[model samples]
Target: MTLEILTADTLAPVRHGFFTRAGGASSGVFSGLNCGTGSSDQTEIVEINRARVADAMGVDASHLIGVHQIHSADAVHVTGPVTTKPKADGLVTRTPGLALSVLTADCQPVLLADAQSGVIGAAHAGWKGAQAGIVEATVDAMVALGAIRSQIHAVIGPTISQRAYEVGPEFFEEFMDEGPENARFFAGGDGDRMHFDLPGYGLSRLRAAGIASAEWTRHCTYFDPHRFFSYRRSVHEKAPDYGRLIATIVL
Candidate 1:
């Protein structure tokens, strides 16, 4: 099967994509391009998936860099390849040979670029990482790479949508504690449950960070199994593990 790489007009003229699970060698629970070595998926299979991504990006497999993605606000600035994936939720690079990438199943895979400044970034922004400020941190790191705050464009990739993201009151409280304005990102669900808008929250953060342009692909991972790999869906189905979708950006 051919790789079904998703792109946005907003990030056009820059080499970037939100890759789907259309082409890969892994099977069973990880049927498509499972780029996450952190999962229980086979190491060899994960390596093959990543190598395919690197080939699609026209770079060495090692140059398609990603982090350990600890769901923290932390961001890493990379100029070259590194053997170890550090513990960070975001990555930025001004160098031409390096491609910044992020892995996600249902969480937001955000790609950012300041084309005029020749800098690019990619982030894995789940609810925890967004609440902890991963999007803002990615913007800051891009700035350090000579990008202007007002010149960056961010696009949130496929993620679970609000209708499928039911959360308890405490989850709602965390956002409410941040600010009541955040309540807009939620809609009342069954009783104490509330549906949280992960992509909406990511857009709010990107816009708040003063990005020049911000948008979402509006692709819902949980709702599209044929084109996406969704963690929440896997859990609901009692799967042992799930494949990870890869999103990439290169300068």
Candidate 2:
């Protein structure tokens, strides 16, 4: 099977992709392009999958870098090969030949670039990270690398959509407590349940951060098992674990 790499025209001319679970060496719950080293998938197989992504991005596996993803707003600046994944949710770089990557199952994998400034970024934004301002943090990191906020373009890729993201009243209240205006991002669900729009909220955050443009690919991970890996879907099915999708951007 050929690797399925989803690219956004908006990030064009720059090497980047939202890699799907199409062609990979893993099996069981970690089948197809499971690049997550944190997963229970075989370490060798995960490395192979990540190598495929690196090749697609025209870089060596060493240059395909990622963070530890603590679901915080922390973003780090990188200039070279990372010997260890830093304890952060976002990565930004102005150095050429280094690919900034993020791993996701249901959370948003956001790729950002200011081509004119030769700066790029990738972020893993789960609900907590987004609410904590991971996207803004990433933008700030990129700016530190000489990127203009007005020249940056961001694309959110393959996340769980609202129709599949049912949450309880407490979850809804969490966002509301952040700001009552956040209520607009939630739709009424069954009784006290609500459907939170993760991608919508991400877009709003990116736009509010004064980025040049931002958009979601609109591919719902939870709704598409064959092409994506969804943590929520795995939990609903009582699966022990789930594979992670990899999104990358290189300058």
Candidate 3:
């Protein structure tokens, strides 16, 4: 199958994509474009997948850079590919000929660019990273690279949606502790379970960070088995491991 890449108009001019689980060499549980080097999937196969992504972004495989993604708010500025990945959830670069990428299963894969300033960034924003301010941190990193706060456009790619994101009272309380207004991002689920609108919360964070425009691709990873890889869905199915989707942006 050909690669299925989802794009947002808000981030136009820059080559960016939210790649689906298609056009890859892996099989069984980690099938389809599992670009995560950290996965149990064969390292060679993962490298192949990442090379495909790098090609799509018009860069050499070595020019495609990613972080360790510790689910923190940390963002790093990069000028080129590194021999070792940094411990960060976000990456920003103003340099040309470099691609910034992130791996996600159900987490938000956020791509941001200020084409006018020649700045681009990619972020891995699971709930922990999002709540900790990954989006804001990414925008700030871009700004430090010469991107204007009001010129940056951000897009949250495929992720688990609210209807599929059932959470415990502790999760709900944790967000509430951040702010009572966060209640707006949740809906009542079965009994004490609450459904969290992760994409909605992500957009809220982007706008709050003063991004000129932000949008979600509206593709739910948990709901689309053929096109996406979902960590939560894999757990529910009792699968041993799940593929990580790759999202990339290049300058």
Candidate 4:
């Protein structure tokens, strides 16, 4: 199978993609484009997967940049291929010839770019990172790299949707603790369980950060087994590990 890449028109003329688990060398649980080096998948296979993604973005394998992704609001600025991936959740680059990438299973893989300013960014935004302001931080990082927040267009790739993201009252309360208005992002689930609208929250944050435009592709990772890799879905299936989907953007 050929690689399946999802793109958004908002980030016009930028070579970017939210890669699906379609074409890759890995097999079994960590099958199909599992570019996550942090996974238990073989290092060689992961490199091959990442190299495929780098090629798709029109860059050499080493130019595809990633981070340690501590699920924080931190963003790293890059000028070239990083020898060691930094401990950050977001990456921004003003330099051309570099592709910013992030690995995700169910988290929001956000790609941001200012075509006019020649800057691009990629962020890993799980609920913790999102709530802690990863989206806003990414925009800020892009701005620091000469990208106008108003000129930056952000697109959130595949993520777990509300219907599949059941949460506990504690989780709901935590978001509510951030703000009562956050209650709007949740729907009643079974008993004290609530469904959180992660993508909606991501859009809200991106828009709130004064980006030119923001939107989610609306593809639910948990719901689509073939096209996506879902951490929650893996847990439910009692699988030992799950694959990660790679999203990348190049200047």
Candidate 5:
């Protein structure tokens, strides 16, 4: 199968994609474009998958840079490929030849680009990273690279939606502890469980960062087994491991 790349018109002139698990070399649980080097998939296969993504972004495989994704409000500024990926959740680059990639199973993979400033960024935003302000941090980093936050366009890729993201009371408390206004992002679930709108929260954060425009692609990773890899779905099904989908943006 050919690689399935989801794009948005809002990010005009930026070579970006939300890659699905349609075309890759891996098999079993970690099948289809598992570009996550941290995954249990074969290292060689992961390299091949990442190379495919890099090619699609019109850059050398080595130019596709990623981070350790610690789910924190950290962003790295990249000028060139590194021998070792840094321990950060977001990456911003003013370099034209580089592509920033973010790996996620159910977490939001957000791509930001400012074609006028020749700056682009990618962020891994799980609940922790999003709540901790990773999205705002990425926008700020892009501005330091000469990208106007008002000129930046951010689009969130595939992720688990609220209807599929059942959470415990403790999970709700975590958000409440941060701020009580966050309660609007949740809905009633079974008993004390609540459904969190992760993608919605991601967009809210991006918009709050003063980005000109931001939106989610409406692709739910947990609900769609054929197109995505979902960590929560894997756990629910009792799978040993889950695959990761890669989203990339090149300047």
Candidate 6:
């Protein structure tokens, strides 16, 4: 099968993509394009998937860099291939031939770029990381790499949409405690449950960080099993594990 990679015009002229689970070697629960090294999917199979992503990005497999996503606001700047993945949720680089990538299965995979400055970034923005300010942290890291705050364009990749993201009262309260305005991101669900608009929240954070342009692909992971991998869906189905989709950007 051919790989399905999604791109945005806002990040045009720079190489980037939000890859779908179309072409891969894994089977069963992890059927397509499982690029996560941390997953229980066969290590060799995962490597093969990642290598495919690198090939699509026009970079060597070793240069397809990523961090050890701890769901924190931390971001790191890398000049070249990294031997050791840092414990961060975001990555930025100004180096040519290096692809910044992130793995996601429902959580937002955000690709950012300032093509004119030759800088690019990729972030794993789960709700926790986003609430902790991962978006701003990524922009700051890019700025450290000579990218202008007002020149960066960010695009949130496939993630679970509001209609599929039901949360408990505690989850709603957590965001409300952050700020009452956060209530706007949640809508009434069943009784005490609420639906959170993760992509909407991501766009808000990107704009608030002063990015020149920000948009979501508007692809809902949970709703599109054939094209996406959704952690929430996997859990609901009682699957033991789920494949992770990859998103990448290179300068």
Q: What lDDT score belongs to each candidate, Candidate 1 first?
A: 0.92, 0.94, 0.93, 0.93, 0.92, 0.94
Q: Which candidate ranks first by lDDT, i.e. highest?
A: 2
TM-scores of the candidates in the order shown: 0.98, 0.99, 0.99, 0.99, 0.98, 0.99
Across 41-104, the per-residue lDDT of candidate 4 in tens digits comes to: 9999989988888888889999988999999999989998888789999999988898899999
lDDT of 2 by residue, 183-246 (tens): 8999988888899999999999999999999999999999899999999999999999999999
How accurate locally is residue 28 in candidate 6, as Cα lDDT from 0 to 100? 88
| True-vs-predicted CA distance for residue 109, candidate 4, Å | 0.3
| Residue 172 local lDDT, model 2 | 86
When 3 and 5 are scored with lDDT, the better candidate is: 3
Q: Output the lDDT of residue 130, model 6.
A: 96
Q: Residue 34 in candidate 1 has what lDDT?
A: 88
Q: Clashing residue pairs in candidate 2, if any? A: none
Clashing residue pairs in candidate 1, if any?
A: none
Local accuracy of candidate 3 as per-residue lDDT tens digits, 179-198? 99999999998899999999
Checking candidate 4 for backbone clashes, the offending pairs are none
> What overall lDDT, based on C-alpha atoms, would model 2 receive against the true structure?
0.94
Encode model 6's per-residue lDDT on 1-251: one tens digit a residue: 99999999999999999999999988889998999898899999999999999999999999999999899999998888888899999998888999999999999999999988988899999999999999999999999889999999999999999999999999988998999999899999888889999999999999999889999999999999999999999999999999999999987
Worst 10 residues of 1 by lDDT: 5-14
The superposed Cα distance between candidate 2 and the true structure at residue 43, in angstroms, equals 0.7
Candidate 3: the clashing residue pairs are none
- Model 4 scores a C-alpha lDDT of 0.93
**Residue 170 CA displacement from its true place in model 4, Å:** 0.7
Q: Quick one: how many clashes does candidate 3 have?
A: 0
Give a tens-digit lDDT track for model 1, residues 1-251: 98888898878778999999989888998998989888898999889989999999999998999999888999999889998889999999999978899999989999999988898999999999999999999999999889999989999999999999999998988888999999899999889999999999999999999889999999999999988999999999999989999999997
